[model samples]
Target: MAPLSHYLVLSGILFTIGVMGVLVRRNAIVVFMSIEIMLNAVNISLIAFDRYLGQHDGQIFSFMVMAVAAAEVSVGLAIVIAMFRNKPTINLDEFNLMKW
Candidate 1:
């Protein structure tokens, strides 16, 4: 079996890639995917640490994160769909963050 350090390193790499993707990508869908990747990376790290520590807290936290991610996906997809209809584009620049 691979060592816990290996898992941690892999998780870190995955998270770094995800952060870079979010920073460089303009499309909402791509950004959403990057967010998911980040979440999954955290999940992997949690599981690895949980196993190493011989405790279940990390696993539980990871499960909660997965639930939250699912809810986010559902609501996020709906919002993106609505935004697409209104703006006819998924570009981040088109979104109005300050408007009431």
Candidate 2:
């Protein structure tokens, strides 16, 4: 099996990319995807550490994260769809639903 450091490095790279995507992208969908990538990166690290330590705690926490991510996706997409129906664009800058 690969070393823990290798998995950590890969997770770090993926997290960095996800952060860049969230910061640089303008589209809501892309932002959501970036968020997913970030979550997955965290999951990878959690599982890697769990394996390295011969424990299941990290794996169980990762599962909880996945569940939360799934719930977030459902609600987030619903909001996005409603906003798109009202504005016809998914650009982050164009969304000011709370503006008066």
Candidate 3:
């Protein structure tokens, strides 16, 4: 079996990559994907710790997070579609619908 430290390191790497994607990407869709990646990273860590400690709480929490992520994706996609209808682009810099 793989060590818990190894799992934690992988999770940390995934989270860092997600953060970089969110920070460096300019497209709204890409940024949204990055956010999802970050969420998955957290889930990975949660599962890893749950396995290491032989507890069900972390697994349960991860499921809750996944549900929340799903809802976020649904609402976020709807907003993105609406924004695209108003504007012709999905570029984050071009979204000024709320700007004064």
Instruction: List lDDT for all candidates, in order.
Output: 0.96, 0.97, 0.93
lDDT of 2 at 55: 100
Clashing pairs in 2: none
For 1-100, candidate 3 gives per-residue lDDT tens digits of 8999998999999999999999999999999999999999999999999999999999999999999999999999999999888887988887565977
For residues 30-93, write the lDDT of model 2, one tens digit per residue.
Answer: 9999999999999999999999999999999999999999999999999999988888999999
Give per-residue lDDT, candidate 3, residue 73: 96
lDDT leaderboard ranking = 2, 1, 3
- Estimate the Cα RMSD of every predicted model relative to the unseen true structure: 2.0, 1.8, 1.5
Q: lDDT, candidate 2, residue 94?
A: 74
lDDT of 3: 0.93
Task: Give the alpha carbon lDDT tens digit for every residue of 1-100 in model 1.
Answer: 7899999999999999999999999999999999999999999999999999999999999999999999999999999999888779998977777886
Question: By the lDDT metric, which is better: model 1 or model 2?
Answer: 2
Pairs that collide, model 1? none
